[model samples]
Target: MAKLDVELKVNGEDYKLQVGSQERLLDTIREQLKLTGTKEGCSVGECGACTVIVDDQAVNSCMVLTAQVDGSKIITVEGLESKSGLHPLQKAFIEKQAVQCGFCTPGMLMSALALLNTNPEPSKEEIKTALEGNLCRCTGYQQIIDAVEMAAEEWGG
Candidate 1:
């Protein structure tokens, strides 16, 4: 297989490398960049555990080929935090106790981030819509919803 050269800006860092045709963006982010916060749940894209922000939109990393997003900007769960402190959403999640089992939190966060980025003040229904793709077996979704609301209120865009 021929390795295709790709460029990506991830979490404020730039990267240029050669990727195999079969390499998915999820593997490139995890294995090549060593950002493991993006989890692989269902490879078929049913589970949103591998969600990430590609060019400011939330997408299932498992479904995207590395070569498909060669020049895109990507943000994973690890990109949410900074040297100052946790992102408002992360703080809200902790305060609302939205994390349970911790399997889907990364995807949930990415989805929520994308929503918040576009809609600073999203209605509960909108929040639900944004998160519908992400499946969380724990927390009953109420806490997660509450966390998103809280983050929106606190961040105020």
Candidate 2:
């Protein structure tokens, strides 16, 4: 297989990488970029544990080929924080105690961020729709929903 050179802007940083045709975006984000926040639960797209924001849309990183995203902008769970402090969603997640086993938090955050980026004032149903692909075995999703609501209240302005 020939390695294709691709450029990606991830977490506000630019990276030029040579990726294999078979490499998934999740593997590139995790192995090449060294951003471990994006977790791979199921190699298939059933579990949203591998979700990430690509070009401001929530997508299953495992389902996308790295070469398919050349020149794309991506935001992972690592991208949620800043030098000043945690992103509003991150703080809300912590405050709401929406995390357990910690495997699904990153994908959930990215999905919520995608929704919030477009619709800052998403209703409960909207939030649920954005996160329907993600599956969390703990917290029963109420806290996660609450976290997004809390963040919307803060960051929605």
Candidate 3:
């Protein structure tokens, strides 16, 4: 297979790499970039566990080809924190006990961040809609919703 060279920014860092034409963004993120924060649940874009922010839009890493993201900017769960502290959503999730088993936390955070980027003051229903793609096997989702809402309030959204 011919390797394609691509450049992209991830979590505010620039990177240049040679990727296989068939490489999925999920694989590049996990294997190459070592950003395991984006989970791979359903590879076909159903579970939303592989969600990441590309150009400020939430996307399923599994559904995107690495070459398709050349020159794009992506934000993963790993990028949510800063030198000051954890992102508001992360803090809220901890406070609300929204994480269970930890599998869905990354995707949930990505979706919530994307929601805030666009609709900072999302209503409960809007929050639910934004997270519809993500599936949490634990907590039944109320805590996640509460976490996002709390984060929104904390961010003055």
Which of the numbered candidates is closest to the native, going by highest lDDT? Answer: 1
Cα deviation in Å at residue 14, candidate 3? 0.3
Q: lDDT tens string, model 2, 1-157?
A: 5699999999889999999989999999999988999999988998799999999999999999999999999999998889999999999999998987889999999999999999989999999999999999875699999999999999995
Clashing pairs in 2: none
lDDT of 1 by residue, 1-157 (tens): 5799999999999999889999999999999999999999989898899999999999999999999999999999999999989999999999999998999999999999999999999999999999999999775599999999999999965
Q: What are the root-mean-square deviations of the candidates from the true structure over C-alphas?
A: 1.0, 1.0, 0.9
**Superior by lDDT: candidate 1 or candidate 3:** 1
Q: How big is the positional error of residue 36 in model 3, measured in Å on the Cα after superposition?
A: 0.9
Model 1's TM-score against the true structure: 0.97
Model 2: lDDT of residue 84 = 95
The worst-scoring run of ten residues by lDDT in candidate 2 lies at 133-142
On the 0 to 100 scale, the lDDT of residue 155 in model 1 is: 96
Could you give candidate 3's per-residue lDDT for residues 65-144 as a string of tens digits? 99999999999999999999899999999999999899989999999999999998999999999999999988559999
Instruction: Indicate the residue-level lDDT of 111 in model 2.
Output: 95
